[model samples]
Target: MAIDILSHRDPKVATDILKIQQESYAVEAELINFSDIPPFRDSVQSIVENDETFIGYMIEEKIVGVLAYKEEQEEIDIYRMMVDPAYFRRGIGESLLKHLFATMPNKPVVVQTGKGNEPAVNLYLKYGFEPVDEVEVEPDVWIVMMKKAQ
Candidate 1:
């Protein structure tokens, strides 16, 4: 697998990331019983305009995973970290996270995932992230915010 920074100006890359995001986040939506997830509502234009840096994972020249984030002076907030559902359990998500940690060592990183998404929660925990808060975005739908200090 090849990992590289994705350019917002590249429509094809953005489109591919959108597709993967939809597929991956759909699983989370189902797990959490929430249909109003942001990824499902995102458009290519919004993704480009979000000003987040995207890192894409490719296999055989096709993008299968993506990690996007916004960097601040004191911390980095992970906007999205997803792997194609078809490629789950293959370590794509882990690789993307490891890459992020390696590139931004010792900086605080934060991420949010559906509260009921055990797989995601476990993955974050595996990487030493601690749950800091829970946010209710809709009725009975909660988001778990986790933080990892390097």
Candidate 2:
């Protein structure tokens, strides 16, 4: 499905992000269980700021996925990532990840997901990310951290 991942930012991208999160994440997952997640009513404006830290993926000219990261002093930390439910499992997420890796020029990348998020863990592992640690952020809720060396 001819997809394009761009490094541009606009208001609609944030709106799309909220929709994607609502669609992709299960209610009980730690990814959503945390108060960190924005409610549907909140706009994605802050998240879509055209900072060097942001990247977005478009399919057929429509925003379908996005990831946000920061190039830190020692490593690249992926703070946010999501794919449109309608477009999940179509390699869009994978392509965006590969694009991020290529764009980062072989830096160490780190990501975190909920322990119950098997799909996310599997996807990260498939792309050479290894589980490095786990932290309990809430009662019975844990964050599984992984890293991939470029």
Candidate 3:
């Protein structure tokens, strides 16, 4: 397995990331009981046009996980962290996250996930991300924002 920066502007790369994103977010949707999560509405064109930097986890040269983030003046805002459902329990998400921290050290990092998604919440907490806020994105659907201070 390897972690590498992904060029979202490339059609093939954007398509691959979109596939993993859709599949991964589908599981999160089911877990959170919310079908309208924004990532589900994203397209390859939208990904290609996004400002966030993308990093991919590859196994035998095929992308199976992805992490996208934006670098702010004082912190890093993580927009997406996803792994193909078929590749769950294989530590792909953890690997991608660790790669981000290792490459961009000394910066505070922030992320948001479905409040009810235990796996995601636990993973963030395990990495020292503390829940900072919770917002009701829709009726009874809460999104938890977490942060790891530098």
User: Which regions of candidate 2 are displaced past 4 Å?
Assistant: 1-9, 26-42, 48-52
Say which prediction, candidate 1 or candidate 2, comes out ahead on TM-score: 1
Please report how far candidate 3 places residue 74 from its true position, in Å. 0.9
Task: Rate residue 83 of model 3 by lDDT.
Answer: 95
- Residues 1-150 of candidate 3 have per-residue lDDT tens digits of 889999999989999999999999999999999999999899999999999999999999999999999999999999999999999999888898899899995999999999999999999999999999999999999999999998
Candidate 3, lDDT over the whole model: 0.94
lDDT of each: 0.90, 0.71, 0.94
Better of 2 and 3 by lDDT: 3
Specify the highest-lDDT model's number: 3
In model 3, residue pairs whose N, Cα or C atoms come closer than 3 Å (at least 3 residues apart or on different chains), thus clashing, are: none
| Tens digit of per-residue lDDT, candidate 2, span 1-150 | 433444445566556666765665544244436544433334566555635465667766677777777888888998767777777778877877888887776689999888777778888999999999999877877788999987
Per-prediction count of colliding residue pairs?
Answer: 0, 0, 0
Model 3, stretches more than 4 Å misplaced? none
